[model samples]
Target chain A: MSAKMSAATYPLSGPAKVEINEVAPRDGLQIEPFIVPTEGKVAFVNALARCGFARIEATSFTSARAIPALADAEAVMHQVERVAGVGLTVLVPNLRGLERALSCRPDEVNLVMSSSETHNRANLRMTREQSQAQLLAMIAEAGKAGVPVNVSLSTVFGCPFEGDVSEAEVMRLAKAFADAGAAGITLCDTTGMAYPNQVAALCETFQRALPKTGLTIHLHNTRGMGLANAIAAWQTGVTRFDAAAGGLGGCPYAPGASGNVSTEELVHMFASMGVDTGVELGALLDVVAGVSDLVQRDVSSQLLRAGPRLRTHQPPAWMEEFFAKA
Target chain B: MSAKMSAATYPLSGPAKVEINEVAPRDGLQIEPFIVPTEGKVAFVNALARCGFARIEATSFTSARAIPALADAEAVMHQVERVAGVGLTVLVPNLRGLERALSCRPDEVNLVMSSSETHNRANLRMTREQSQAQLLAMIAEAGKAGVPVNVSLSTVFGCPFEGDVSEAEVMRLAKAFADAGAAGITLCDTTGMAYPNQVAALCETFQRALPKTGLTIHLHNTRGMGLANAIAAWQTGVTRFDAAAGGLGGCPYAPGASGNVSTEELVHMFASMGVDTGVELGALLDVVAGVSDLVQRDVSSQLLRAGPRLRTHQPPAWMEEFFAKA
Candidate 1:
């Protein structure tokens, strides 16, 4: 017998505190075709706020003409009742969008830019430097307004158009965000191009480079590795993550890219492993159901289909009879 | 500014060798309502054999009446042309099934029972003790017949009828299987009830008690933790795994339990991490397509749906023109 396996619980060893940021309202709904009405979006965010998520990306304040799905972001954000612990973060494109989002008085405003120049051009309709310059200004302006800033560096792992991205480039952008009065940074696997190894290596770099700044990972499950990569990231000491209600969200630009990692699934995995996410699984399930109703389509969540692991079934009649006789 | 992030590439770390045992022929088809033809089953097994799978569970020698889906197990076993590198194993329920499987001269015969008594009765229609005694006899008989025996302990993590199986109970069954001269013992998450922590714990116990014996994991993606759990198991130093092509298995007894971990997806994950599974992803994808044809339905494969992560899309017209203009 090998001595390495002497202990029973070694491999499942992971960090204790994992804060999940619900991004259903921002990344999740931004791409949905059927516009989730303002009231319904507000209700959903309010419901999620109660489900023990410490952070929620409420909605993106992009141009209404661009992402029509989240056109009512101001109304949705202003309408939702803020919970004491939940930090409502709204996505903004530039200075103009920041002004509109600040009016809603979200707890934080998140800025976006792509690590890939081509991706930045396609997603934000500007070059990477142009978006960065504008975002640096937004950060400075938001800082003046006393609103915390978060930067989501998209396509850090790989881009849909340009293929593999360099780690140095991602760090460069992350360093820029950290230096520009940004409170937090999110490394976005924009189209599920992240592998576990890449996630770990990147996270190690992030932790070493900017240990004091808050870090979050936003992953998509297009290639079915959202949770797996998230686990890898968590192992490297990343405590915050971006998850969608019922695995909502897909890239409107990147073809075949699917939903973000399911919030309930992440909560389920962490809870199962004895890690604390402070989520109420039963209440989270209700929010998932509500999201499903709001979308009127099947959500890409495995937990939604198969309930919690301990959910038992009554033994078959034959087995019951045989056991009863026994 | 850490040296780790200074490198352009990092993160894809894994064990050099990962053994993948394809189980679609047995576990994948056992629950199908429509019976795959005997010839198709043979060809599918033969096809999987060529796809760099070192092991394949060819069929189950259970009573034809008990599982009509695999009633042609004998015919399928006889027709598959034995390949040099592939070890074609067969599943057996009891001494009678072992006898039937031995007649076909399989490379290995896997004995079956459940960790939970009720699951054993429901699955094998016998008490755990009775099944263990019968399996011990089968092991002795198969040993004398110069055939190897592999025992699969089903529902070692959690049982549908009896939830939260104790680690001690699982270790007891694994120890029994090891003592009975079984060549390998597979820990079966028959109903997708096994979480990563439980997998890690049981695997540690198994390695401690039977370190030299062959160990394999049979995981289902029922709750979507299949891949996440697989990563956990890998971290614990267990490499051999049982995966179904196209994720083609389901538990008949455990209703709503979904398919096994998709073999191609596993291959993809390992390969992306620079680990060697010896299986060609493109060839495996074709095999997945063929299995989908045989089953006549869409199987739960993320790779089949989204393609590989590096599979680049032709940048959309707008993005291409934008970049061209830039």
Candidate 2:
């Protein structure tokens, strides 16, 4: 696309490149109405790995009854061809989920619980303390198994059923995750409540408080602020973010719609701003096409319709003639 | 919904409230396939005024042949109930459009031109200077007629037909507008080509250059960056933004689909971030619903379906029971 440059150009402020965690196979598809076959899921993930994605959240090991869409999570986890550097993450809600996830030998396990007292009970069917205690046990198991662990704390910004969340509580949860040996901590907006200022403020605080821990912000476009929040986070010194292929929300079945902040959109934004994503964007589009085929519907990608920003077209006849004369 | 507060309560690092100029009447309807009757257009403008939008770009006075959707612009302008505080702006291309628009007594006239030479030629059928010189003359005419004038410079960020735009070129155009007795200046993304950093950078530059001029960032979400760019501009101290009720683009004889940033979505984002937007979120939703009906399809709005971030639902039975036990 003519609208974007290959790179931002040498020099200038901002990180040299930002890392994107592709969560479409896991997060995007988890809530999809139809379950994509595990073979297709594996092929899809393997394709994403070749696109130079440093990390891919391949699947979630929740109950088959709870999330039948990801019922073959173990198969997808085992079948996706692991690349040399790409990290494969599977969402493990409880110890049982972690144990099932471990049997398939995932590169990393994502332990999730909401920060809100009410949401944790609703989503995980356990109190915050109970979930945390169990996650600590899972972390101990994961550490021994030589697999790193991360925690996704939902409602860190706001909750759907709850009105607002306190920054103090969020900080406490992040601190707990750091103390519990989480390889990284992800601040999940849960319902797209994040704004740029809040993102900047939280990232600033997290960097100061947990200097050793890597920080990731998972955002939803439910309110259409995903890319905006991502840019703010990136500008505020955050380097890792979770995004879906079509920006599909985690969906009603999973959490929310993984959201439609389509990964293509983020890649386009970073590339245009000269921020390196280390992704073959053209190849990724093919992957998106494959995804659209599997979903049997259009994915929430704007670039697919508009082409790249740099894309140009000949002016219409009247305009061309008028300009030609002038 | 309970997800949004009536107004932002606490002080924020950025401007407490941002000004939103509803552009659906002109920008949104222009691209629409069918020409709405004058009474519907009048009612639409009247309703937007009641929703607390201080400025509404009511209609464009382009030739009927050029843009049939707004052919009855004069009738709509004269028929709409005039709200005292609302500034109703009409887009006028040259002296002829300006003259016809003056007969209808618009509050403001917006003269638009593209910054890139190729786009300027294709879109306006004139050299950049020719368009600017004519706009200066129109400004003089509007000044004599006691109508304030503003200029909308398109492709200030990037052009689909051309490539990237020069900041120098954009600054020069702004300066010309300043010297032409224009009351305000709007930097339009045209085809959704703006990036947040570039938006922040350009607004900062323009502010330094034209301290007295009122600046507005008119963005399109074509690339899904409309809200992102708008937030960046607001944080950088550019308070005013132009948005459509349903993220409609400037379509010509289309039912409606422009991809401009949705006004309701922006209001929700600002409110959620504790930034006040004088517009009532609930009343604006009514407007979005109305627009969706007029377009005969769901408009490109997310919150219209998702409701506000503070919106709450009863906890699921399982979660309620789990929490009750605790």
Candidate 3:
């Protein structure tokens, strides 16, 4: 069969290149029980910076009392090696967090809220309206400082506390943020409840609603649908994604669920499909090795264990002998 | 924002229903370090039978010397409860295995061989030519006994030892078997080497080549592309899939690789997409739990850990109290 037939057979065509936004330092490290040392964190971010990622969410400027693991966010941001092409994005939860992040001159600032009121209150300790107002203000504040903002709207697919987050609600928030000067809007699958169809539908809607705004999909592999959702989103023309090294960072509320989609696995999938991720698989894997060592445990990355798809193995001795006889 | 736009946005459309073939008994148990008791194996098969799978590959009729884990295949087959609608398929390697499987009067007989010459020799201890002759003969013999045969073409995607088994070779072998009266063919990703584009391409090619023959895709999650490949195959209109409960069953040759595409996770994905899988997700999860208990360890099923997508959780106590104050 011709390659044309294969491409035609697939429903949605993907872009020539996808932009991977590395979120390990901020999202992955935020939920760890033990904090990674400031120096180790710096080294990790610096290693990721060299891997050709379009952006690395280096750290979150949230209160030290709230998230102790990223208490040294400022230190990590200041110390990490800044490559010319790779943008360093930092999470800013509020005006206070934005001020802290601004002092470091972040390349991009990420704001956070939730589509589900219950999840917003449970996660951010505020009502959805209150969180939206706060995030919108942060976006305007960051815009004044000439820093672009990407708002990560959590539970855009579904909420653990409340069953379904309506599509209209998600669209409303996304449009509101995009109109209010946010450069990007990331639809976050906070607890990994997003399915492939839901991802495609919402991605299609968000892309249509805010055609100029950069859209990113942040997914979790909690139900083993992370890569599937990623593929669906990509097919629907989403070019930006948020993934964590070693698949770190999970919601504490979703017991037994896995963390973010592994950066290596996602890049590997796109690369295997002949789609350019602009990230070197080998260099990215080497960085994951460091993440694993720093975590002091096996992280949930499949590629780390299985190797790449093209990695070859030696035939068993008996098989060789049998083949010789043949 | 309409549902029609969402459906239209998605590239290849999916069928309203899909068939799931449960392979935990034969594929999953065959590679386990410890053999489950015959009674336990019977109980496991019986549980899966109730979960609405179109077919259950109960056991292999291989020699006791070759696969000790499935040595009691006949005993288990005779004792297990056979639900009327569920077809019981047993793996038959050659004439001898086919004779043994025929005695049980199985609903279907599954024949297996590797597409790669080296994998064929290593796995079956015979050259590709020898395996083709043997399996074709078995298919003829099984047809004489009025038992349908499905040839499971191992390493159709890629071979761990040989690597990059040519698609032309896979197509040549599949066409050979289908021309020889095999009722069905299963493309096995022996090492989880199949990616989405490759799967869609091959599925489209195979369907066009043998439109009358039943086509099934068997996948492994070794590199975390299991569900993504499945979605691709479904989009290409190949409805039959082979999955294992708890994602049990892996290729011993691909060291450190995970097992088959998870049955529960696959079912959950299709169900979430508004496709009818016939199988009840809750019942399948229960069966997976039983499989885990029988194996005496955790199986790699994501749904078992995360629960179903709509399973709601109560907000944290502190959050609830805070909301109460609000």
Candidate 4:
């Protein structure tokens, strides 16, 4: 074994902290088969607010026909009780969505566009240039409303339609958004195609390029690399992450695949590593259980089934008897 | 962004390679509800052998009544085609198991013990000291038969019955085995209690202490940190890993949890990171499909469902029409 392989270079040392943005309400519920009632959505957001999350993306102000599951975006946004430290964010698709979201007085509005032209066109029915220009216009409008903007660049890692999205393309979009007065930028692995190396390399570049802007990683567990990618990014000092409770949100295009990295699992991993995410894991898990109930199915969360890492189990009856005899 | 977050410290740079040990036929099948026939086991092992694994743990030599799922261990081991590049390994529980496995002419024999006293007794029906003495004697026996011995220290990270196993305890056992001329030592996270920081710390120490002994990490996906821990260990230059096909095999103790990390998922993660595992992921995925069928259930493999990262999808019908209009 080489001495160079030692833990001297372990990125996290003492009392490190990361910000978790809960996106289950908007990202998770948007694609669900069952529509949670507006009250239920409001209740869920309130529950998450108490869990110490830095932000909770309450709902998306998209056209009702586009995502009927979260059609009650305004109701959820207006009804949710505000917490002092937790910022409430809502997705804004275009100028209309931004105007509606601004009327609700969201703390921050998230705008999204795809890095790959094909995915951009497929998802937004507009080309990359058109989406960027529209989002730039939305950023200016949201600025007038005194709300910060976070532009989520979908397929910054890879596109389902176009395959590998280049680093240059991702940098261009991220820089464009940062230049347009966006307070933060989220790199979305829309199809869970981002691996650890890709995540680390991109995060390093993004962080260096936009040191003043907050960087968030939005990953899916579609390929089982969500936590791996998140940890890799965290190792590179990228502190903000987007996770859905009970792993609820997934790409509509990737059939049969899991959703965003589970908030409980990501929190569990960071907490186990002694990195503070400010969220109480027990509280987060309780919310995850409610998520399972609200969604009417077992969600894709590992911590939901296998408790926390420190959870102990009793030995077999035979072993107990043998030990007693001994 | 700090300069410390740069890719200058990234672990893998060139054609880095790691060894993968397929343990599905043994560890994976042992915990399954369905029992595959002897020929099916042989065929599965043969298929895995062709996938370029460094080693294939084919079966365990224990009483048929103990784990009836793998009762045909002898038959499967004897019938598996001996691929030149792939070493066939079998689990040997005691002196009798060593003798039985020797008769089948296994390329290697893996002994078992638990670092925790409670897990040791619960798993092997003996004390840790007694198990170590017995394994040492068996190692001498295997040495005479010219078969190398690798001791798998279960719950090295944590024991379900005995919450946390100490690093000193793990180091003591690993050093004992290395000093006794064991070919390798596998640190088994019997339950997925391992976080990446713990994995990195332990792997670094184990690698430094036993430089000559091959270090293999056997991780479970119980808490969804399987790939994260694997990558963390890989970053520390501990190359050998043990994975099961279709992610079969769970701790009969940790109910409602996943089993070992899926072989295809691990291979895919490494392949995606540009790290060479020498296993053809497509071939491994095909075998995973077989394992899924043989188990008569959908196994806990993400790659099995999501396909590879680069698998492109055609845009929706409307998007295609929109593109055509453009």
- DockQ top scorer: 3
Q: TM-scores of the models, in the given order? A: 0.95, 0.93, 0.96, 0.95
Per-residue CA lDDT of model 4 for A69-170, tens digit only, reads 878888887789999999999998988888889999899999998999888887788988888889999988888888999999998888887789899989
Q: Candidate 1 chain B: worst 10 consecutive residues by lDDT?
A: B1-10
Off by over 4 Å in 1: A1-9, A324-326, B1-14, B323-326
**Model 2 TM-score relative to the real fold:** 0.93
lDDT of 4 by residue, B205-248 (tens): 88778888999999998888999899888777777999988888
For candidate 1, write residues A1-326 as lDDT tens digits.
Answer: 11122132355555677788999988888887778888889889999999999899999988889999998987898789989989999999878899999999999999989999878877788888888899999999999999999999999989987889999999999998899889999999998888887888989888899987899999998776788898888777778999998989888887778888889888987887777787899999998977767987766567877888887888888766777787
Model number 2 iRMSD: 4.1
Ranking by TM-score: 3, 4, 1, 2
Candidate 2 CAPRI classification by DockQ: acceptable
Clashes of each: 1, 34, 3, 0
Q: What DockQ does model 3 achieve?
A: 0.61
Highest-scoring model, TM-score: 3
Give each model's whole-structure lDDT.
Answer: 0.84, 0.80, 0.87, 0.86
Model 4: residues with Cα > 4 Å off, grouped in runs: A1-15, A254-257, B1-15, B254-257
What's the true lDDT of residue A149 in model 1?
Answer: 93
Question: lDDT per residue, candidate 3, B191-211, as tens digits?
Answer: 899998889888988988999
lDDT order, best first, reads: 3, 4, 1, 2
Model 2 residue A173 distance off true place after TM-score fit, in angstroms: 2.0
What TM-score does candidate 3 reach? Answer: 0.96
Q: In candidate 2, what are the lDDT values of residues B205-243, reduced to their tens digit?
A: 888889888898998877778888887787567778899
A1-326: candidate 2 lDDT, tens digit per residue: 01333334221134657788999888878777878888889898999999998799999999999999999987887788989889898999877888898899888899888899888877777888998888889889898888999998988888777778888999998898789788899999887877777777787778889988888888888778888888777766677878887676554623343374688888888887778888888988888877777766777467677766777656555776676676
